[model samples]
Target: MHNEPLAYRMRPKNIDEIAGQEEIIGKNTALYHLIKKGHVPSMLLYGEPGIGKTSLAHAIAGTSDLPFISLNATVSGKKEVEDVVAEARVTGKVLLFLDEIHRFNKLQQDTLLPHVEKGSIVLIGATTENPFHDVNPAIRSRCGEIKQLKRLEASDLLGVLHRALTDQERGLGKQSIRITEAQLLKIAEGVNGDARKALNVLESVVIASDEENGETIVEDWLVDNLIGRIGLFSDKKGSHFYNLLSALQKSIRGSDVNAAIYYLAHLLETGDLVAVNRRLLVIAYEDIGLAAPHIGAHVLAATEAAVRLGMPEARIPLANAVIEMCLASKSNSAYKAFDAAVRAINSGNTGDIPPHLRDTHYAGAAELGHVGYQYPHNTPIGSFGGWIDQQYLPDKVEGTEFYRPVQAGDEVKLAAIYERMKEMKKNKR
Candidate 1:
């Protein structure tokens, strides 16, 4: 066997060979067509580590038969980029794959913009960080597309493991090694959808088995020893953390208690109590909304308890909050209403405040026509007896309907109360 790492030896030779990322590289997909035509634009591939960003870039270059040049933005400087650009200018076709493109500073990224614009090189930038936040806008704008890769599914990882086992030319097929389907699945789960980690762990087991005995027969204990130290796949400050948070909220919104708790466990494993607390609060108010406004207060109290108690113990209250929010009646009316109002303001519908509703305590307020303000509490048609007819919003948006409550949980009662109040106001008018 060549001494190359299994991940390296098993790199896909073409787009068809790439595992996972079917959304991007599947037949008839935009990226698949781009590579098939051998005319890809400057692109950014973004996702968590070991999800095949580098592999896909190489596959594109290989399948297209384009000259491939690779650089790591973390180590390479402006000089390296300039050198690559110069070389690419000489060669009419070159696919420059820059790994960890987020590591490049503004000056370094800017250096490649013109070359990319001029078609000197078809840039394929790979990053684990979100390009919008980490990459220079100028460079991001020049990239024709940003492709997001997801964590590989267990089935896909299993396929990768099998390929390494049986591909005699490049893999360990020549060795007398045997791994059960169950053992392969165990390693796949342990690696958290990372193909590189899966392969490395598999390779480690094979080597250890070889050293111990000429024949390599993988066992549960051997795999356990190698994988026992591997922690949950998470980066506290990276896209993985945010993705988990999103999943948690969506699960709650979808009322999938199991999924919500699952993602909650992952966040707590990272000791990210604050993110969990904040996102739970948002879900309570945004997702749960007026359907169960009490849940918002309950979630706040739980969050407070979590903060005071801290992890291990904190997870209890957080879990309680998550379950309650998940089971609580769901509504987004409050959230949508706020967004609608914001849109109106942005669209220049913010007319002058009704004079009667304007501040009247100022010295010249009465003379400036701010005196018609109704004291609803003092009036006979006040809320004590019944709601008074009044214009609360600015004239431009006077009759705008924003808070349309759905017949969900407490919102049903709210809708009834609102209709009654509107009727009373209409009678006064």
Candidate 2:
């Protein structure tokens, strides 16, 4: 308002003034509990940008009456954290706020963990990525995670736009700017639920307005200016993680190996190495799965190597891993089969394990009518020693082969193996 940046000027000072995130800001929520009674926790706040992570950190700071010391994980290291912790000893209710904390290396992250664990500082950290995969285990283990969902509804962004236009000391009220319902709605929808983005776009309008008789109406030209001003190859990293991830996932899902590879390269080149680990591992399982079953092992191992080796040295391995991963010959029989089977189980048709398939490890098994469970390995077929009438998959589920392997590349061999196993198990009875 007073020549400050729109983001800072528009920041809410009180709980009621804070927008959205009612679930977290509510009295019974974790952050609210930490606030109301001053029960601050060593916690990680993760979500996309403009979802109130930073503002929530401030709300926590304000509620606790602590000397909130914040450091950028992109720049700060162990030395800085240690210095802050030492200063916090004399201070009462010390809270250390870490932003973009996923940027810290393992050793750097490792250092702050002990202090958080030992209660030296009530650590409140923020990240745009999933901390479970993004943060080192040492730091993540000691902290509680409060997931902040991205703004997805038009109403949510509208609320912020309204606040920004009306909030006297903070928003366009300082400049006496006004906007029509349709124009505001258009801007809100364009923001895609990002409150910061919505406000920023509004700020552009406020600055561009010519003060038409002292009331500002955001015109179409200004709207075009805002959208057109956003550069394609700009800072699309932190603020647009989900967007990039969606594009990456869609590229893979749509079977465009080149586009998928391009996304992976972008992700590895800029984002964390471990970010792709989980999805790649799943692709190995879901897409590759039983087809080239060993590919999962390769994908997982490459992720580990990338993390251990870090950048430059890690680049080739990451690229190679994802390349093999993308071209591993897709198949979703594992997913299709598992999903169908899960639907059956969840619908309460999960019949008990047949006596023949159960209880060989216990002591009283042979004594309590626990007999006639044949050992398939000792049979003539050397396996699959069960009879078809045995109902090994439960009477209602027998002979239900959910995983029908695809007739492509490696899956053909996998399908044959599954067939053989079914045959062997069928004869064992």
Give per-model TM-scores. Answer: 0.83, 0.58
Candidate 2, residues 197-235, lDDT tens digits: the string is 777777877778776786666677778678552312223
Q: What lDDT, from 0 to 1, does candidate 2 have?
A: 0.72
- Evaluated at residue 285, the lDDT of candidate 2 is 79
RMSD in Å for all candidates: 3.7, 12.6
lDDT of 1 by residue, 255-301 (tens): 99999999999999988889889989989988989999899899999
What are the Cα lDDT values of the candidates? 0.87, 0.72
Which runs in model 1 stand beyond 4 Å of their true positions?
1-4, 14-16, 26-41, 132-142, 167-169, 210-213, 229-231, 338-402
